[model samples]
Target: MASKIDPILEYDFCVAFLSNKWHTPPSNLKDFVVTSIQQTKSNATNMVSIISNFLKNKSFDPYVKDCLRTCFDLYSDSVSALDNAVVAFKNKDFDTASTKVSVSLDSPVACQGLFNDKKGENKSPLTKENRAYFQFSVIPFVFIQMCRIHN
Candidate 1:
């Protein structure tokens, strides 16, 4: 007999972000991939909303405001990429899905880079959010890799 597999174990990096119910017994690979992508898209959408709210805040300096605007654009691109990823997955195009997910993953890094000066003295207010989004974005990519391995 085959040994039992754990879906949660396959997504170790996502454990902190995943809910208690997501830790239950193993699910099929397709279900896991779908869930991972959908959850990531949802998280990215929330990030966009958070950044949008930050852009509306008038207390920040011009430099900070410019950084936030760039970050906002980056996150918007991420949301669009993830949306395309979802459609690719639905179309059973794993390669396209993987490519789209990879594209979505770069937003946080690019956003964070905008705040670093020559001396690296500047810090981003969205540090925590960017880190969280990066982690969240990794889930679907990992799941897609798993699917590739299984196939």
Candidate 2:
């Protein structure tokens, strides 16, 4: 989906170069990649807001509540890590940026695991979307770091 792909399109070239799973991107690619990192930053900020709102308004069983709390913490941590990564990038500290981005990637896995551990099914819609958002959030930085390696 273009919506899914748009956030990380700028780094697509780096991904192709690193993975050996290369393919030529379509024309008008620049327009697609034209979305700046600021948009991802905004998305991450919005994630934090959404999670906080959900946590504040929702009530559930204690275990499920705990799980939600954990997810909230992870999302917050990811937002911080992503912000730090951006700062590192601006400072030309690519290694530090990469490390921060790598750390942020773990939030989704942990959050998803929290859901599965609670039950086989019936994951909350908010958590599902948040997990996907967390995954999407890290992708651009991944490409940016990879591009740094190549260049």
Candidate 3:
């Protein structure tokens, strides 16, 4: 129930999102879903970034803020890795990129209670870099939906 957006309903929504964005004539629902799922996974981080941009670039909505808060804690470890990469890059240590990616994957930030006591600080469900991760989350669902349709 955490992700209140119902997968059942969102499958249809995803199809719509796809039809609007892709102009190619897919062979069938299977192809369309497969392509769209791949693209969504590939661009997931981009979508997260876009959503984060939407949050920070504009006033925060209460509903959006709540939703973001729920998910942001889950992303902390990933954010720290991004921070680490920046430090390594600024120090001209290119060799550590692999390590940085490793840390980000394993040491994600704890987003629980992140906004509990903070006041006057802008809360993002995702930071600029974290937004890029959103795409990663969307692709699998679409892929599964495609399978369902094909089957």
Candidate 4:
């Protein structure tokens, strides 16, 4: 029930993340890996939709507009990377899957970085979304790493 049976994925955040998302607990590493990939893909897809909505808002200033546009691009790429990762996972290519997942993880950080002004006064409107995406992205990378190690 703790969702920490795998020593490689014993982190508290990972366990809690999986526990919240999974209705039936994962029985083994493959279950964990498959679920993690699916969930991360779903998260990325949702993020794309959210960013698209933000882009449609016409009241945002030019600076915020620029940041949102870039963030939208990053999240879009993240979705593609996660999609490729799903195929790689199905092929049992842990290396390719991990690489793609790792690429997906960078999107959140890159998106967050777009808000850092020179004076450090700007804040990302997507802060919460970026945080969730980063966490969702990490779970699959960790599971894929475990798969690589065991295989």
Candidate 5:
């Protein structure tokens, strides 16, 4: 019979991966995880705020405005979901944290989907602005996967 993989080892690997991705040395494992999740949440919130402030002051075509507004709402939802995930994780409710993080991933996808037409051409102004969000979004998914591995 094959030996079962230890969850603590898996969790350590996950934390190391996140720390490397963030280009920061690992400190306390749980603290690192919680702080990294919080940073991702802050990023999502800040991006939404910036876009919303722009939309509020500028004049764009009605269609464009609607698209921007949709992106704003999606980003906001992502932030909220991430917040919930972090809270759940802190509470040691890994299942709830995983679910919330998984849900949060959809927001960015839906936000990006707004840029596509039936033919799937991507031309939304938000694309360039929001690109960084997509990059960082993967970390949360990784965190969720790590939790699964730990479980």
Candidate 6:
């Protein structure tokens, strides 16, 4: 179904958060959204700020900054190092996969392709490079964080 809100402003899982119901993973349309967030390993607290900023903090017009902070924080243990390891494992390139991540900016794909070009390994640098993660998490959370921000 076409959404009443623009894809830019409209959260990916707008219907689910709007309805305030359990997001039955893999079945609910919101599942895709939750899946995306889970896959990204976004920081819980920073992410909530972006979500709340959109849903509650209608001032300062905080947009992507909130999301970027969340993206960079790796307390969840799903950082680029882990990603490269997983990708290498899948491709059988454990040698490169085992390398510790220390990225800068413009090499997110490096999470899978280890070329010793430690760039884009972390979201913090990229966030400063380009305020995109804000849109990444904030927009999506608008549909998921219907409960409350933890921190």
lDDT of 6 by residue, 49-96 (tens): 443444443342233345433333432233444355345434644334
How does residue 14 of candidate 5 score in lDDT?
44
* Residue 66 displacement in candidate 1 (angstroms): 1.1
State the displacement of the C-alpha of residue 59, model 3, in Å, after optimal TM-score superposition: 15
What tens digits encode model 5's per-residue C-alpha lDDT throughout 13-124?
Answer: 3455455655555465555557667777888888788778868856666666777788888888878888888888889887887677666566666777787766778757
Specify the poorest-scoring 10-residue window by lDDT in model 6. 103-112
Which candidate gets the maximum lDDT versus the true structure?
4
Candidate 1 lDDT tens digits, 1-151: 0111323233444555455466443378777777777777887888888888888989877777899899888877877888888888878888999999887688888888898866876668899888778777777777777677677
| Model 2 / residue 37 / CA error / Å | 4.7
Give a tens-digit lDDT track for model 3, residues 27-99.
Answer: 8654543454334433434434554555564466675566564454334444455455445534545445335
Residue 36, model 2, lDDT: 22
Better of 5 and 6 by TM-score: 5
Each candidate's clash count = 0, 0, 14, 0, 0, 5
- Candidate 3 matches the true fold with a TM-score of 0.35
Regions more than 4 Å wrong, model 3: 1-8, 47-122, 125-151
How well does candidate 6 score on lDDT at residue 18?
Answer: 40
Residues 1-151 of candidate 2 have per-residue lDDT tens digits of 2324345433553343334332443244221121223345556667667767767765665656677788778777776777777677667677787677666666666766776643477455366565556546555554554546555
The residue pairs in collision within model 1 are none
Candidate that beats the other on TM-score, 1 or 5, i.e. the better one: 1
In model 2, state the lDDT of residue 55. Answer: 70
Residues 1-151 of candidate 4 have per-residue lDDT tens digits of: 2225343334776757855856877899888777777788888889889988888989877888899888888878877888888889889998899899888889988999999888997567899988878877878887777677788
Cα-lDDT of candidate 3: 0.44
lDDT of 5 at 33: 57
User: Over 4 Å off in model 6, which ranges?
Assistant: 1-26, 42-130, 145-151
Candidate lDDT scores, in order, read 0.76, 0.58, 0.44, 0.81, 0.67, 0.36
Clash list (residue pairs), candidate 6: 64-134, 103-121, 104-119, 104-120, 105-120
